[model samples]
Target chain A: MHMIQSVGIIGCGALGRNLFHNLKPLEGLTVECFCRSIEKDDSLYQSSVRKIEELFHCDLILIAVSDQDIIEVGQILNAYSGIVAHCSGATPLHNFNGKGGVFYPLQSFSRSVIRSFKEIPLFIEGDNEETTIQLYSFAQRLSNQVEQLSSEKRQKLHLAAVVSQNFSNHLIALTQAYLEKEGISFQALIPLLEEGLGNALYQNAREIQSGPARRKDTKTLDAHLSLLKEEKRLLPLYEQLSESIKTYYEEDF
Target chain B: MHMIQSVGIIGCGALGRNLFHNLKPLEGLTVECFCRSIEKDDSLYQSSVRKIEELFHCDLILIAVSDQDIIEVGQILNAYSGIVAHCSGATPLHNFNGKGGVFYPLQSFSRSVIRSFKEIPLFIEGDNEETTIQLYSFAQRLSNQVEQLSSEKRQKLHLAAVVSQNFSNHLIALTQAYLEKEGISFQALIPLLEEGLGNALYQNAREIQSGPARRKDTKTLDAHLSLLKEEKRLLPLYEQLSESIKTYYEEDF
Candidate 1:
C-alpha cells in the first residue's frame, strides 16, 4: 500500500494489455505483465512481459485473466505479500490471497479494439482501508472516474450489466439470425434499431416498450408463432421472450 | 388509383397527428384528419377534424388506429370509393374493401415527441400496380425512404421488429429495474450499454457476445442466479435468456 511503487498485471488479454500500456507511462512506477503463453514478438507490450515470480516483488498484483483462470492465478500468488486485486466485475474480491482488493474496469474491452481507460469507470474495493486508498489512488492515475464499491453491490452491478449489455446483444443477434433466415437484408432494421436505442436512452424503457407482447394481442402472437413454427430454433425463443414480456407488463392492462 | 389530391387520415394518435401536420403543408394536397373523439379545442390539428362521412370524399383514406380497431374501421370504409389504406406493419392489406393498400411507416411514434419521417422507412403495398404507384408517389412526398413490400414480407418485418426493438427495450427496462431494486445508480451502466451497442453495430453481435451465458461459465452463472433467486420475476427471465443463449452457441464449443 506504500505509494504502489511497483505494479504487476497478469494475463495479456484485452483488459490486461490495455492496463499495462495505460499504467506504464506514469512516472516513478515500475510495471510488469505476466502472460502464461505470450503472443508473437510483434506485439506492443512484449518487452514488459515477466514471469509470475517477478510479479511477487511488486507492490500490487492485478489479475486480468478469464473467469475460470482467476482462482488459479490467485492461488499462484499465495506467497506474494503485495495486495492482489482482480479486474473482473463478476468475480469476488476474496479470490486473491493477502491484501485482497478489486480494481474492476467496468467496460467492454476487445483484443482488436484500442480503448482509452480515461473515460472508463474504475470500481475499486480493498480488503482494508489502507488497501482501498492504495487502489483508489492507483485508479485515479489512469481514469477520471473512480469509486469504492462493496463486493456485494459490485456483484449486483455485474448481474445488471449482463442484462443490460449481453442480453441486448443476444437479442440483436437473434434478430439478425431471423432476418438472414427470411432472406432479408439486416440493413433494413438498422435505422429502426437506432431509433429504438435513442428512445430507450432518453426515456424509461419500460414505459416506451411497444409490441404485441406489451399489448397482449393474442391474434398477432398466434400469427407470429405460426410463422416461427417452421424455425425450430427460433420458435421457442419467440414464445419464451414474448411470454416474459407479457408477464412483465401484465399489471398495466 | 387516381391522383391523391385529397388525403383523409383516421385516428388522432401519435402517428395520425404527426401525419396530419406533416401532410397539411404540402402543395396541392387538401389534408383532413378524422378523430372518433376529438381532443380539446386549442390542439394543433383540431381544425382538421372531420367525421367518417367526410373522409369518404377524399382520394386516399389512411386508418391509423390500434390493431383491434383496424377491422372495424376497414369495414366502415367499405363504401368509400378512394384507396383505403391502413398504416400498420402487422395488418395485412386485405383489411380494407375498395382499393386496399398499406402505408406502414416503420418507425417509433409517440404523442409527446415530434418525429421526422425523412429517415423513417415507409413500406407501401397495394392491391394493384396503379394503386401501388399512387401510394408510392404519395409516400415520396412525405419521406425519402420508401419501398414496395409484400403483405407477407411486411408481416415478417413486423415480427422481426418486435424482437429487435421491443425485446431490447424490455431487457434494458429489466436492467434498470434491477439496478433500482439493488439501490444502484442506473447511470453506471450507460457507458457500458453504449459500448455494447457500438460493438453490436460494428461487429457481428453473435461473435461479440461476452457474458456468463456466452462463455458458459457455470460458476459465475450460479453466483448470479443465487443473487437473483429473491426476485421471482427476473429469475425465470435470467434462466430462459441464458438457456437460449447457451443453446444458441452450443455448436461453437
Candidate 2:
C-alpha cells in the first residue's frame, strides 16, 4: 500500500469542490474537505472536517485555497509528514516547504460543470525529485497527459493561460455586449467562435490570422472604426490591436 | 430546372477558396473560382477572366474580395441579370443597389483547412423577399443553421464576431508568445483552452469566470503584474482587462 491513500483538501472553492467531487469516486482513495464551517450533508464525500488536525491524518493533503492563503496553509501543514500539494498555475511549489508538490490541472474548473480529465494535461511541480515522481504518478491516475513543469515554466504557462482563457473570454463578453446593444442575439456569433477556436487547433494561428487588420485594408478598418462612434473607449483598443495585427502580418509576410 | 446550376467565386483568397472548396462537392452544385493569377496545376476549377461578362453565363456569382473592391464588383455584376452576392459580414446588402444580396457565412475561414458548414450558422440578407428566401434555401442545402438577419443586425453580429473571433485569436497569439518566451510549448495550454471554451458552450460565460481578477486574489494578480515588468506596453491592457473582468463578475454576481 502507498503512503497517500487518503486525500485532504484545504479549501472548498471551485477547484477544491471539483477535486473533492472527482476524487471521491476513485477506488482506494478516501476524500475529505477541510472547511471553516462543516456542512451537515456529507453525501458528496466521506467526511468534512473543520480542523486541520483532523485532516493531518490523511497521507496526501491538497491545498486548493486562494493564492493569498497558500503560505498560511503551507505553514499549517508543516507538521504533517504526508505529501502536500496545491492547484495553482501561477504560484511555485517552494511556498509549501516540506515534501510539497503541485497537482495543477492545466484546465479551467467550475463547480457547475465537471470536465473530463481523460486527455486534459496536469502540470506537476515538486520540492524535490522524489516528490515530483510521486505526484506525477498520482496525476497519471486521473489523466493520461502529465508533465513536470518548473516554477518558471508554470508562471509562463499561467500568463499564457490568462491571455487565452481570460482575455479571450473577455473578448467574447465584449461581443455579447455589442450584439445585445443592437438587439441581436449572441447566438449568431457561436458559429464564428467555434470556427475561430477550431482553426487555432488545426493550424498555426499566426498563418491563419485574417480580417481587415491582417490585410491592412485601411478602408474597411476605417469604416469599422467609424461605426464604433459611440464606443469611444473601445476605439483605442481597436486601433492599437489593428496596428499590432498589421505589424505582425507585415513582419511575417 | 433552375437557371443557377453552378456558383462562381471571384478572388481565390481565404473566403473565396473556402466557399469554392465547400460548394464544389455538393451533389447538384458545380463551383468555379476566378483567380487573378494563373497557376499551372490548380486541382480545382479555375478561371482567369478579366471581364465579368466573360463569366456572365453562370447564374450565381459570389464576390469574396476586400470591402474596398465590393462596389466595383457590384458595378461589374450589374450588367448580368443573375443572383449576385458578397460573402462579407460587415458590408450591408444595400451597398449593392438592390442588384445583389449578402451571403455572409458567420464563421472564420482558412484556405488550408476543411471546415464543415453543417453546424456553422449562415446569416443571410437580401434586397428582396425572393432573394432572401433563395439565399436561405441555398444556405440550408449546405448548413442546417440559417437565419435571416437585417443589415443593422448583421453589423452588430459582425462586431460581436470581431470580439469572439479576431480579438479572441489575438489573445491566443499573445498566450503563445508568452509561453514560447519561457521555453514552454503552448500545447500545454490547449487542454485548458478547450475546457474553458467547452464550459462556456453549456453554461453562461458570466457565471463560470475565474482567475486572479475574478477571485480578487491581489497576491496572484500582483505577481502576474510583476511578471509584465519587462513588457511594459502590455501592462495597461492587462490592468484594463483585469478591471473589466472584476467589474463584470461583481455586476453579474
Separate DockQ for every predicted complex:
0.71, 0.57
Q: Which ten residues in a row have the lowest lDDT in candidate 2 chain A?
A: A37-46
Total clashes for model 2? 0
Candidate achieving the largest TM-score: 1
Q: In CAPRI terms, where does candidate 2 land?
A: medium
RMSD of each: 2.2, 3.2
Candidate 1: pairs in clash: none
- Candidate 2 accuracy as lDDT: 0.75
Tens-place lDDT digits, model 1, residues B108-157: 78887767788888999999888899999999998898999998988998
- After superposition, the stretches of candidate 2 with alpha carbons farther than 4 Å from their true spots are A25-30, A95-97, A112-118, A251-253, B1-8, B21-33, B44-51, B94-98, B112-117, B250-253
Report backbone clashes per prediction: 0, 0
Candidate 2 lDDT tens digits, B100-143: 77888887666677677888888887788777777778888878
Point to the candidate with the largest lDDT. Answer: 1
Candidate 1, residue A213: lDDT:
93
TM-score of chain B of each: 0.93, 0.89
Clashing pairs in 2: none
- Candidate 1 local lDDT, A145-252, one digit each (tens): 999999899999999999878888888888787777777766767788887876686678898898999999999999999998888766876888788888887656
